[model samples]
Target: MTIPLVTVTGKSVDDKVTVERTGFEEILPKLDGNPDTSSDDSVNPLERGTELRVTVQSEVYQAWGSVFEQRIGTDVDYDPSTERVSFTLDGPPTRGPPITRAAFSPRGTGTHIGKFAGTTCYRPTGGSSCTAADVYLKSANDGFANCFTIEGDLVVERLPDSGSLYGSPGCGGAVIEGQSFFGERLSRSSAYEIKGDVTFEGYTNIRDRVELLEAGGGVHFKDDVRIDGKVKKMRGVTVDGSLYFDQGSSSNELKIGDGTVIKGDLVAHGRIKVSDTVEVHGEIYTTNRKITESGGGDGLVDETGNSKPSSEIHKSHPLSQVRGEMRRDLTHMITSDRPGRVDMSAKEPATGDPAPDLTGATLDCDADGTAETCRLGAGTYKLDHLILGHGDELELDTSGGSIKIYVEGGVEVPKNAHIQVLGNNPNQVEVYVEGQGAGSDTFHMYSGSGAGGKVTTPQDKASKFWVYMDPSDEVRLKQDTSFTGVIYGPGNAPDGDGVDIYLDKQSTVKGAVVGNFEKFTNLATVKYDATLQNKYALAAGGAARGQVAYLRTSARVVSVDS
Candidate 1:
């Protein structure tokens, strides 16, 4: 293979030397009819508009226009005879006068980023290095050979004793101030600096970050606030409405007035201390310090999926945490208890089985309902109906096993013995007893000191009733009272409503006669037959001292709900 010798026409170089583009130069690759290895005068790459292989050696480089090739004449002295190339430059360099604080046309192309002659007046003293000047950057197309430009003499004079550098009375128009000025947007009379405040009538957007040394008055943002500063202090930084610090922001101190309303979430890595109350419409979660509120409703939800009353939940944790804690507490209460309530309102198909008569029968619940035994085992015991003997106690002792007592129709425990129904979940226990057959009665849960015997009265629609008691053997009913399965017959019981305790004709009612009663006037000395039917009230032999009572009439007696 033949060697590829690269060379430039006007410039000769050693065999190891290479031609390349320098800083900010754009170069195009060589194409057909381009410079050859033995060419004399090199054509300008820009004028020829031919692709050229230029070694890139700088951070930026460029070369692309056909105009550069025309500038190189065919007989022009080219340095490297091994290469032929051409190029041309369109025009001479154009420069502009140094711009002062006075107004000037920023329309035409001009050198901007150059040393301008102006008194370097205000040299910040308190360790603040900031030069107050109308900075005009060089045009994009202009070659930035010099960074500073001065039409007059270069002077470094001490700034006159001035209190403030910007927005002062005499310093008006000297400060290039406006709400984001641009090329065609320069104001003619609005010199660089002005006397009055630099009013950013609308939103003032500085594409670059803004740094404030020390602002006396508060910096207000009708829209948003984005400041990068080492330390910022103000009486109050008020956002027109909501305030949001981006995720990356790490503010030292952020405080809101007493009644400030935040409609969004607040996330901060540093410490956030609220002086007074803080009302957030969204969730509030903090990983660092404490979050507090002065006073408000606990509109929180508990994990039970229950909407806790605003008056109950404490204002310590977030709503989610509060809810979780509540659910945990409830679960402990239900599972931890020795006998928790199992609402069996959904179990048991209704069967027309008669109530089990216990008048002359005895059962050892511990013997699997077959024989009498003291140790009751774990299993479900079904009694279609229960009829307590005139005077008997039902003893059920299940120490090692979990037993379930279920009565189909209802349960009636003689006032004599104490009854108990129990079960367990994974070793824990549950109890339920319902009374039935009669009107309505409650399950008497027997307590040690007459406090545990509970009588659960089933609703009129439900067939059975319940009585969860805790006694073992002996007990007795009150003299004139009888414990019925569904309804406890405290005959002529004075505790019932007046309308439910009325007396029959044989026994007069001295107090109010409350139950609904109908009078009859259609009996004309009726005669009796072989198949005769008659009804009569037993006579009270002359001594008619009435009793005070109420009877349940058309209205069925209703048990008071706890």
Candidate 2:
């Protein structure tokens, strides 16, 4: 329930300490009640040796999303000059978590620290979790707990006799919206125009303003979903619709290891096994016969059966449809027998010249190159097997224009091999890897780049370097390296297996990604650049099926904490 907002690393002197975090908005200055004292626009610092207990709580930063948790430490100070916060503490240890960073405010003075009776116990579920807020009325305790977080989706097993989550979720009459209660659905009272299935480049306060619009329900969400870089609650908002991330873009996530986050609806093909740690952001739409509970039951509890609910858990769908028997709506296949999900037949190697092998040659396309540097200029180059292995330096000069390379065989960029894009425009280079067989068509983006050949583009311009893989083999973003580009792959034929991209635990991707299959051993944080989508869809003269996206909503006004 507590996040070491930012750990307090160490203490310098007894009265002064150091923190490992930054970005303090002037520790909430003590709420002085004096009137008309505008002359001194300065905080009245705590008197010397005044052992102050500082609760460095998170303040609002719409840009950073939301600070959903809290951490505590003692003794705080803010320097206006450096604009940083310092701390004084009861030196180390006897502790839970290290003190986090914060602006100066008397500990426990904020409304967030209010003492209210709570049950952490949930009911029929279905309630929106708000920020550290003291709601307008009695308390906030629907399946969505009070100020505290509930970890995953809250589903109503049995709506209280009131037939609503504590009478429209205790936020008083305000529209529970913004990055805090994003994708959440409530019963009545004031409602935010929250649009489900948001294909967002960014989210606005007005949730309905996005490209997609639909109310969500009747789906089962599983696992912890973390939006990389978007400051959010531990338990993310349940999508009334679906966590259809980016129909166009994929996710670079902190879904951790085996930590899959399914936001909105879930319709599995067979019996759904609910794990102990598995969290649902929405209701599970399956017959009691179709679902089973494993592990200690915190995820799904049945009040009626005292074990698993006999009735199906749904958001809005009718029970008769899901409870009696598993119908077609509840059982379906994701990979239906279909041919060619993507349109890749349009762009083929222009029939012009026989493929040239750039195995050991340092062929410079324009200027005279040294023995080690191979320069490629702005032109359509067709190659059979391109292996710029160890000691090969290939320079793609896009200053003249865009460079398109069509390969008929496998391409390998091994250790010590480097490919540099000598251009600023993001959409300047294209490399399509397509060969006769699967192994021959493999695009080895990473082949023992033992800590080398880290290719990057100016974040927003990540689309500048495009790699097309017809039947993608594998693209691994090695550890300690950052990548910025679109990894396009597969699906031009009915028998194709779609796209395949592998990501390393420590690797970070900055652009878009579309693959039929993705593997993550650890957390892969992707800071997506939305601009790449347009250029991707237009690649190969607008015949490209689509690109990927890591939807990042820019900072906008979600609400004003009163």
Candidate 3:
């Protein structure tokens, strides 16, 4: 059906020229002092004139009047063939501001794992997380190499600190590490340093390599477990899972425990000792290549394959490190290069520019989302003690760019305080403290009471908020409350009995932390956001350990990164 167009008319022809507009079509105006004919096709509305004017269906459509006023660009040349639709906004659009603070990757290539640098302890109780830097958790207080008291199941992975929970394609299947700095001669294991002997209270799921340089105390599986990794320099290994031995080395004795299963071939140096059922999927390759086995339960139940030892045992294997130097072997195996541990130093947080008074002006920093809101857009703000005590909701408008807040004195956030950031990256919002010492100079964020203070964003984009304050006070990152940024409260012990950075059992920190981490009243998880390593130049303003090197090569290795 050919629908006829209805043109709304006005008496004042000069002020309002009528244009015919069908259902969602562009307006075809009568440019000249004549009405457009009914059969007239769409034509350019511009008449030869210096100024431009647009005619609508009626003078009552005043919206186009304001649209033309805010139109950007030089010329109004008409393109008759093309029709374009646009989404218009009355207010200004949001854009990240030109960053003022210096921006640089703290770790030049992010090869260091100093993300969780704790003087006392860097304890990960239950959950696991990725780290961009090498974690130096050797507690100075405790004698051992950071006593890892694993009760349930404590995990530590060497994944990228990509400010995300899932894996990334940047590293693929390869473990993220600086091999040049941590070569086999340099590093034994990848990103962990646990003292004492080896014991898998849970299931043993390992690949690559898990070195046990010293078995003076002997290895033990306190519970039912599975073993898969390549263990070295142990006196004897009793397998609960499968076993693969390099029979090509020396006459290595084999001690198979109860219910032992072998995925590959089992090659023992001396006579095989079995207490229970021994099952080998492949043939046994030993020194003499002859079948010689003894013991209780069931000897070589999978004797289905040829029971004799195969003769592939003397093809010149790298038996140097395996059997030792003919004299000092298992007893002389140094646990780990403990004496050669890389001397570590933490990145102290920026104390920010000092404040003259103990407490300054309180902000109208309350957001009710209706009449009033705290608009903390992009830009650097130097205030004295920002206390978010009033109103349940406080919103920081980060629509412009990164918001760097340098607070003097301290900051107190009470319970149920909902601080919403309008930005994405947690690095985009920073609050650096300029505390004096103890007392009012502490950073106090009271959360985890009922429903704690949640400093989240519209998307709650992983880890998205940060605060660098006095280490002597309480920055509670607890239950029902979620903050998504790095917390650097390094140096200075917590005063009398106060905790440095207290996190409750149900609390989980998205980013990393640097302080005297001791008190965790409950199970807590701190997944180090690797993206924060050099996410932005450690630009906390003042009193910060500005971009310290893990191990500087030359004195003139100054990275002129912006």
Candidate 4:
């Protein structure tokens, strides 16, 4: 595709140049490269002045240069020492990449004069987008004002002592086509709206209103955050630290991770899962589903069902609210009325057929490796059965890409076996087991007398790991084995094929384990990471539109008398 270019020429020494668009070649040398080559190819390169200073009026800019005989500008000064010379003009500022967008870093704390076309990221120092310590958006005519909408992501990272994002009074708002991130803390009086997923990595003090219009990826806060204004229609949010939501505000499917605290009143349309030792300073209000507290003696608390303030929590059976919700969600995935078909009258074997012979099975590691140690590379492998004995080391390497291990029978990772994941990201590995027809799939992990080896992913990529089994399967994690990932099985099937998850004594799950029925015994913990909902949603081809539609189904309006 041909890119239309704009040229800025100085009539005299006192005149200045203004760029109304994003795609413009560099007219003057700002660094080591010659600027004269960027001028009109028909004009003589030597005709342009040798030492010239060109001031840009846009927040984003891109310049292309060609070969020239002599030197262009001898001395050029551009702020932000980490700026690069070569940049691509993606498209017009209103449009994204593959068009006329300019790829130049804005320097100084002054007003920028250009617009951007594609997703723009500003890091401290990188080739991607803007990464300045402090960014100032001046008058509507300056900075990113000319661009009505950013066709891509808009990320802003702050320096250690940097302040909040500064915008002029005339700045209406910003529309980002992709995700938006603010690395630093914002003041209590700050107000803004984001169309994509928003993340706040630092301590954010929220006093004013902040709206996330289309949070398809969900909102994440890594540190402490307090919301004083009303947050309406937010879905799938995770707070690593303490979260304060004002009274009477509503959200959907909120998960509070481990070691976090929640303050103020919270109303959710979906499930509200809390982890061990989490302290809720205020009451929880659920409009549709119930609240499940992991590791705590109080089991599932249904805010809509029994109104005795609380009910006898049962760990063996699924929460009444959860059963209904799961059935609905599973129905969306499976169409048949008998979604999970398994005969309840048929007698099933307690254990799977003795591990099938490994004669034709694909081997991931060398045959010479002893039961104590083994190594596996990333790829797709089909196995009849997978057995990891005690003290055995199974290293799964997925640095190249994601690894999928499909087992046709059962999987047994006995106690004390070391399962180390080489990749730091959890999304790098997936294990699927297609058990022997109905009610035969089994994942057994017996407890050892002492501490067993852990099956965990790196702390940062904790949510990437996944394990999928048949609808009617038995998954048991016993005695000191820690797992950090998602375990997805079938929902309730009264006629038979219901999944059962048993977390016995000292077992801890950092992510989620979804099944038809779950039982926790002797200090077992299930810390729900709410971000996984969004991750799983995206993985299932669900759009990350931020808000939950079900919560907004019934709307009401009331007039207040002044």
Candidate 5:
């Protein structure tokens, strides 16, 4: 439908004039000091207490005043004070339809036409304010016509089934200046873009491209997504499916969770950590580089690139010469009985011992809604201590996404309890335990036989689970428990009191184990997975860093009053 054209002339009129009509109705003031109603039968003569009914197409319009009732359709130019209606031949309204106040809350599946000066929230039911969890919109065409800035979040999701209020399932294009959340089975029909951080939670679907112009908070995708545009400037990202950054995205860090089969090229300036196995189709570029320049110099390799023997190379290379000097000093420390003399094997823990006692607030996962007796969903959990009782089976479910657990104290897994991860994809769980104080934190796994209570991830995709503990802490893997995953304890023997990792009573570790000091007793075996080195390599750079300089330099200042 075409927008009606209108024109207005004159400031005030003493007499009445005939309202004319072309192909469309035209409001002409009859200001000749007499009531003219001779030609048009639809309008009554200008007199006191007269009701005028004028219809232009199908729209019904009404204007409120003290004297008379005025009705016009489509476009009408009527001064509220003068009680006069005029028509213009101009184009569409110069500005969008003016709303009296900002912060509008629209109710359910119909179109709302106006330009909101402030925030616009969509709710399933009409209310005095917008405070609902989810809002549904069929389309955003007319509803968000000229709204360029929104000061708050735009939430669009499906209403609950029990509520009488409901809305259409999907929305059209939207450009929001604030954070956006599309949750709970809601879908976007066309391109959806946001200036702030955006999250897709609980099975929401996007039919077209989605873009984030400037997001400091990061984009978190808990479900699958196949987008057509680039995502930029996110601090970090955690994804469960194939993420294709079509235009090459940048982030400070990235975590590829389980079920992620394919990923696009990442230009990370910080770190890109993979949980399990991830197939990257594009190059992984990083800005962090150790050696900036390479050439021949004083006592180093020459530009001619001539090969030399190990003894000669060690004498010439600065780093190798330093290492040789350190080896000599260490040899003296080992042989001599000086005050600073060192023993290499002194840090290793004594054999055949259970884990240390754990003391902290108990975390009941079932009570906190994070887990049940049999199943646990993907989420980040913070706890004081972790304990799995005997004979209880707890399954970690990563089908929804990844799970990260952070403990401040210690962990205890008793005999006869089963804690296993259940998912097809690898690298779905990471457990981090920080030392509470000196000699207080420890990781203990009890020994048992014949269906013993063992804690383990999937054996085939053992690299998916990563356990990182403090350097001063002790980790004890008791008898009859087969562990599969990477164990990382950070510290060094000469520099500090290093970590102690003990494997006892025929326990086997399928993945690699790295600690400051490790001991194996009673036929325990550690079959290191050499391929894990390449899988979890600290490559050039992982995800691209945020372009803060570019964003600041590119922004233009505009007057808010204008």
Candidate 6:
């Protein structure tokens, strides 16, 4: 290809010129190299200009049937810092059909600007596409390009290759706007590494092990993938589909959303959220990061100690109390007449009265039997292993103190059963406290006597203790059986101090009842449909069998004539 010859000279101050397009020889001689010798003959370079360097402002430069096209303006100006032949073209005109390729060393003194051969061809499939990177190597037909490296920011709207992108170690790090290298895999076997950032809005599938020494953006897998190396550290490793980490590969910061199925142990130094069911055969440990659900729901700990669904809760400041209080104050509630005065600590000590020394004492009901007309005084009591029956009631009139009730046992209160205290009426009750073993002092039930109603203590003041009730016989309840008390852990009397109440679904209970009363935790075998197995069921707020109607709370022999 014959080169174009054009003069490049600016005399004095009046030598400003403008042109749309021209050849390299027209401007090269005017830059700083040679003024007389043409830019095409490869003339022995001469001191082109002694004073001001000639400047050519043109949008196009052609040589040997090739054009270096620029978009807006091409202004050649003298930069005092470099004092070299310098010009700035507002980049190449967008990106059209690749016409030619030129190699130029932007810096360094005697750097050679080599000319390499290349093909300027477009994709036959029009628009743009890519290939999933595998393990093969690909190269452009550029003699100087295959061995050279590209530094600085190399932006590409899309780069679709069907082979591996091999970069010399000197390529340093090239940032790609889009992520997935469709058919071309990136191979760093030449000791070259991606030391910069790779922002992929798509999936990254590695046919071989990916050893990332430093990466800014997180590795996102938009589809199913298998990684083969240990992920040192990543911002957020998201697997939109399933992930199969090879034998030795592990992820550090993993964010697994719904539709993710992982086949390896995921170790994270940060929080991990899983919105779907996760089944892992490997161990998982979160040292400090809390696991939660991305979508909203109550946080629960499954039987396997795995965190259930819930939103993320940020950690509060350390060394501070991070607790949730379950308090509901009703101080402004109306009164149904102040309770009548009952002098429990009177000197006369009436018969069938609960001892005043029962304060700070514990009471427990028997598992095998029931306590009829049993009454208890105020005390910090632990009620366990017991069945309370026959109008059994516990009343407290202390001031400025609350009670703590913890029951691992079952409790029940029949209809119309009186468990509260009458104005001055009291009854004999047996209070039992379980032994904490050793000589820790156990409060035994009234096993060898008629009835006991006093509090047992090891000396005078007692702080911590348990209560074990005496084994008694059965306590039956007719209809209208009212008991104002608390019951826990339903089971047979021979089974220990737990209380069990068998009620038909038609029975009504008026007292506040909590805990699973259907004796669910005590069965030998659990059925698929959660059968009570001839156990008990409570019916409150009017419910009965056969009649489809509820019983009224008023006192009467409300008889069925049939």
Q: Tell me each candidate's TM-score.
A: 0.20, 0.36, 0.42, 0.34, 0.31, 0.17
Give the candidate number with the greatest lDDT.
Answer: 4
| Candidate 3 accuracy as lDDT | 0.37
Q: For model 1, how does the per-residue alpha-carbon lDDT over 210-274 read when each residue is reduced to its tens digit?
A: 22211233233333222111112222233342333222233343433333333333333223445
Q: Which prediction has more favorable lDDT, 1 or 6?
A: 6
C-alpha lDDT score of every prediction, in listed order:
0.24, 0.36, 0.37, 0.41, 0.38, 0.25
Residue range 452-471, candidate 3, lDDT tens digits: 65566544342346565544
> Which portions of model 2 miss their true places by more than 4 Å?
1-346, 350-371, 437-441, 447-449, 458-460, 477-482, 492-496, 538-562
Root-mean-square deviation per candidate: 48.4, 27.0, 19.4, 27.5, 31.5, 43.9
Question: Candidate 5 on 362-404: residue-level lDDT in tens?
Answer: 4443223232354556655555666666655667677756666
Candidate 5 off by > 4 Å: 1-374, 435-441, 448-451, 492-496, 537-562
lDDT of 4 by residue, 398-505 (tens): 665555666767766666665677766433566666666424338766657746546766652435566666656777777777776666554343233345666666
What is the C-alpha local distance difference test score of candidate 1?
0.24
Model 5 alpha-carbon miss at residue 92, Å: 48
Question: What stretches of model 1 exceed 4 Å from their correct place?
Answer: 1-218, 227-234, 241-252, 256-267, 275-287, 292-562
lDDT of 2 by residue, 399-426 (tens): 6666777766666655555667776753
Top-scoring candidate (TM-score): 3
Clashes of each: 95, 22, 16, 26, 23, 39
Q: Candidate 2's C-alpha lDDT?
A: 0.36
Give the per-residue lDDT digits (tens) of candidate 6, residues 169-269: 33322222222222112343332122222322333433332333323333334444433333322223444544433322122333343323333333333
